[model samples]
Target: MANKPSPSPTWDEYVSELGRNLQRARISSGLSQEQVAYRSHLSRYTYQKLESGIARPGAPANPTLRTLVTVARILAVEVSQILPAAAPDLPEP
Candidate 1:
């Protein structure tokens, strides 16, 4: 038997958590992944990957402003609610 390859490491935990939050919000808003994808101008595969936590949310594929706005519009909630809060402090450049 051959050893299976490991899955890609998620870029960030915050993105993974955000994916969960988005899914919950979507369900609460009574919309399917496909519906959100279509309305958000994203492919179903992209949306599925996002909801499944396979893709990192708020990253390149996941952090599209269009997606956040679409989700907010569909869920009737503020974007901040679904997305993780920003760090309160940042190191100076």
Candidate 2:
């Protein structure tokens, strides 16, 4: 039999978790979306979309790695802190 791919969360789920993590980190850092966005050299709307995980028509935004790095720097957090943790692998018997 062919090897099967591991199951993972849907794209929407990953986006939502990333957004939530960014929001929490921003809140903890006592910064508003506008403040962070400006500092990160991004538009407020873009940052808002990233943090809300809704770009258009209820779809998730596709954020770039550069954007994430910028946001993390502005928020004084590591990039890893803004990303969601991966699910642990299952153990074999």
Candidate 3:
């Protein structure tokens, strides 16, 4: 028997979802990207890019985990809620 591959989301869908998550957090906290950037020690442009889904790899490119933690703190939410979960690999039969 052969294992079937699961369909993954399209690139655009992935980008849009990430962007939506960022915007939702920002809006829920009544904060602008600029405010989050300042508090997180990230540039406004970088934060904006993240919110716009212009940042490549469909995720924020913050080098350090501390940077994401800072942003999560500013949003008053768990980092896991914002970051994408890892997809399980297809089984090899």
Candidate 4:
């Protein structure tokens, strides 16, 4: 029999966990969302959206690498620390 492919993860799940990671990192760094946004050169509103893991009212977030890098830098965390473990559906390089 041909091998079956597994269901891919909903990116929302990964994004939600990433948001939690960012929140925890920010809390640990003792910075408010506004502070991190300012330091990262992002608008407070944008940062809030990032932290909520939502791009819009009902859409899942898909942040830029630049945004992730700056936020991680401000939080004193490696980007890996904030990223979820898997992207099984992602295309192999």
Candidate 2 differs from the real structure by a C-alpha RMSD in angstroms, to one decimal, of: 7.2
lDDT of 3 by residue, 22-92 (tens): 78999999998889999988899888876776666545333346766777889999877776553323346
Candidate 1 Cα misplacement greater than 4 A, ranges: 1-11, 56-61, 86-93
Give the per-residue Cα lDDT of candidate 4 at 28: 98
Per-prediction backbone clash count: 0, 0, 0, 0
lDDT of 4 by residue, 43-76 (tens): 9998998889998988988999999998999999
User: Which whole-number lDDT from 0 to 100 does residue 66 have in model 1?
Assistant: 76
Q: Order of candidates by TM-score, top first?
A: 4, 2, 1, 3
Candidate 1: minimum summed lDDT over ten consecutive residues — where?
84-93
Instruction: Give me the displacement of residue 12 in model 3, in angstroms.
Output: 5.6
**What's the candidate order when arranged by decreasing lDDT?**
4, 2, 1, 3
What's the lDDT for all of these models? 0.73, 0.86, 0.71, 0.88
Best by TM-score: 4
- Candidate 4 clashes between residue pairs 3 or more apart in a chain or in different chains: none
